[model samples]
Target: MQYVQRADRKIVGYEETEYDQNRRNSRDQGKKKFSRTMALILGVVLTLELMIMGAMLFHIDFHSADRIAMVFAFAVLYFGVVAGLTDK
Candidate 1:
């Protein structure tokens, strides 16, 4: 049970059942897990992409076109994943 008071001095009582609280807690946990997982994924992907670009910039002997293509592919894939995540 909870009481909410308005600025006008009106009082309102609300009942929060245990089941409701548990369900809310579980939902929050799920969202946190999802966000963490997505963050990890994006971080790894971005790191790898940066490393590749850095290698290319330093003349690492990789074919220029191929390296650029790979970077572009990764960017597209990342955007797709982002779209999917945001769709939820």
Candidate 2:
């Protein structure tokens, strides 16, 4: 357990902020593993998407609309994953 000492050098009982910070720290420690896993997955997905986009462009099938869609989709998915799993 972690603790904070007050200005007077006395150990203060856990305040709400301290509790929240500790909770966030613990949660983030666990989520480090999850984050690494997700990073691996995202890397593969992004690579595949890039390959597909490249192939489409090579075939002259790429459109401005497709690029826009891909950008927006990637942004939304990235934000959704991060925000959905993050601790306050």
Candidate 3:
């Protein structure tokens, strides 16, 4: 594989060997893992937001109170997804 970079308005080419590809793949995997982690965190936040909104609408109703469990549930799921995607 070969990669080209623009330096000083000129194209510079570098030969990418198999080892380079492996390293690049690892780096790309890291990026993917980070994105997934962010997405999981966002999901948790959104769940909490929805739960809060629901509770407000219900005005302390029992069914709405049940949604409070969703916050912890979603948090666990978020961590699980992130941990599964990332390498130890």
Candidate 4:
């Protein structure tokens, strides 16, 4: 057991066992991996969405409901993905 102090006051006494330290390190590593994976997936999705939108806009062929629907779907998906990733 070790005593933790602050400003000459003993806050508490707790033992930081090796097992606890190892568990904490593993959890941190997992979070890093998850964050990296999410960032990569989101980056690819966003890039593809932007490219498609740019092509459609430059062509000026958004005259059909199908095209508009597709754009709308992409917009919804983009927002949904962002929200989902950020909520974590």
Q: Pick the candidate with the highest lDDT.
A: 1
Could you give me the TM-score of model 1 versus the true structure?
0.35
lDDT of 2 by residue, 11-58 (tens): 866546677888888988874434656755765576567657766777
Clashing pairs for predicted structure model 4, backbone only: none
lDDT of 2 at 51: 55
* TM value for model 2: 0.31
Off by over 4 Å in 4: 1-12, 33-65
- Per-residue lDDT tens digits for candidate 4, residues 1-88, read 5677878785988888999899889988876434756765885678587757876787744454477676786677766666666665
> For model 3, how does the per-residue alpha-carbon lDDT over 1-88 read when each residue is reduced to its tens digit?
4657676677777788889989989988865334655666766676667657766886757555556685576667656655665545
Q: List the residue pairs that clash in candidate 2.
A: none
lDDT of every model, 2 decimals: 0.71, 0.65, 0.66, 0.70
User: Judged by lDDT against the true structure, how good is candidate 2?
Assistant: 0.65
Show how many residue pairs clash in every candidate, following the order shown: 0, 0, 0, 0
* Runs of candidate 3 exceeding 4 Å displacement: 1-34, 61-88
Per-residue error at 48 for model 4, in Å? 5.5
Off by over 4 Å in 1: 1-11, 33-68, 78-88
When sorted by lDDT, best at the front, the candidate numbers are 1, 4, 3, 2
